[model samples]
Target: MRPQLLALLARAPAYGYELKQGLEQTFGPAYPQPNIGQIYVTLGRLEKGGLIRGQEVAQDGRPDKKVYEITEEGIQELAEWFAAPTEGPRVRDEFFMKLVLAPGTELADQLTLINNQRRHCLTMMRGLNRLAAEEQGNRVSQLLIEGAVLHLQADLDWLERCQEELT
Candidate 1:
């Protein structure tokens, strides 16, 4: 359950807030960012599981911080999790479902949803592009940023096509 959080921490020892921010920044705003409480609780759980260990770091003018590092077992578990091909039922796309159910749904309503999604995606894409460009020496980072932009562009194009078909 907290495997992802644990895996992320395993990559490098990080303070709870630092880990949370890094995940949020990586995944973007569409994904729910785990709160500090959840991070601490999960640290406790992972400590109990023996997958990870944390130490309280004393800081001046700040709350004592728990820094987490993945254990050998944790590294093995994380590697196995990464290597295994994930299997699950296909996730339902609610937008498509809405169109199916409401055959007579107003074009305006569908367009509204598409446009809203597009706006959010565009903003995120621009921000990611800027961040990646600032660190342009990293080919992997550049690829990730451009890949996200391309996917969002495809979605926007599909939305346009859907609008034309509906009209």
Candidate 2:
């Protein structure tokens, strides 16, 4: 969220509301809507960190609004963030933990747990596939769905390996 907001501010100085709208427009529905208070809090932090500076502007009929602009430090931070690779998906999911630990626990059969989780993954994949097909024009959404499908496929494969090992 910090880097994203910095990137937006790097483009132009904008008030908190404008930045919020910019995020919605840029990410579409893929990004969840952030609370206004959250935006203000983030802005405050950025200002305190010297990554951004906020200027209070007096309005004619309303309260003064603080507009934020990215600083050189923010741009450098954004560049460093862009260069860093994102961490891979978690291998030790909660479901996997429960499956491995359920043998001696009061939980039901481990195989049944694996099967139920596999079914849920398949269901999610089907829904994502449907969304991808329906949103052919929305490239961003399609890409996100495709990524989800790939992850689900990997999870299904991992479940098979778990079953083989546990049984």
User: What lDDT does model 2 reach?
Assistant: 0.87
Q: Could you give candidate 2's per-residue lDDT for residues 1-167 as a string of tens digits?
A: 89889999989999999999888767555456798899999999999999999999999999998889999999999999999999887877799788878887776788999999999999988877776677777677667777778889999999999899997
lDDT of 1 by residue, 1-167 (tens): 47778778877888778878777666554445678899879878888999888899999999888888999888888888889998753448676566445556555366666667678878877887777667566565566667778877876787688777763
- Candidate 2 lDDT for residue 157: 97
lDDT, candidate 2, residue 29?
A: 51
- Model 2 residue 167 CA deviation (Å) reads 3.4
lDDT values of the candidates?
A: 0.74, 0.87
Q: How many clashing pairs per prediction, in order?
A: 0, 0
Candidate 2 has which clashing residue pairs, if any? none
Q: With candidate 1 superimposed using the best TM-score fit, by how many Å does residue 105's alpha carbon deviate from the native?
A: 5.4
Residue 70 of model 1 has an lDDT of 92
Which 10-residue window in model 1 sums to the lowest lDDT?
Answer: 99-108
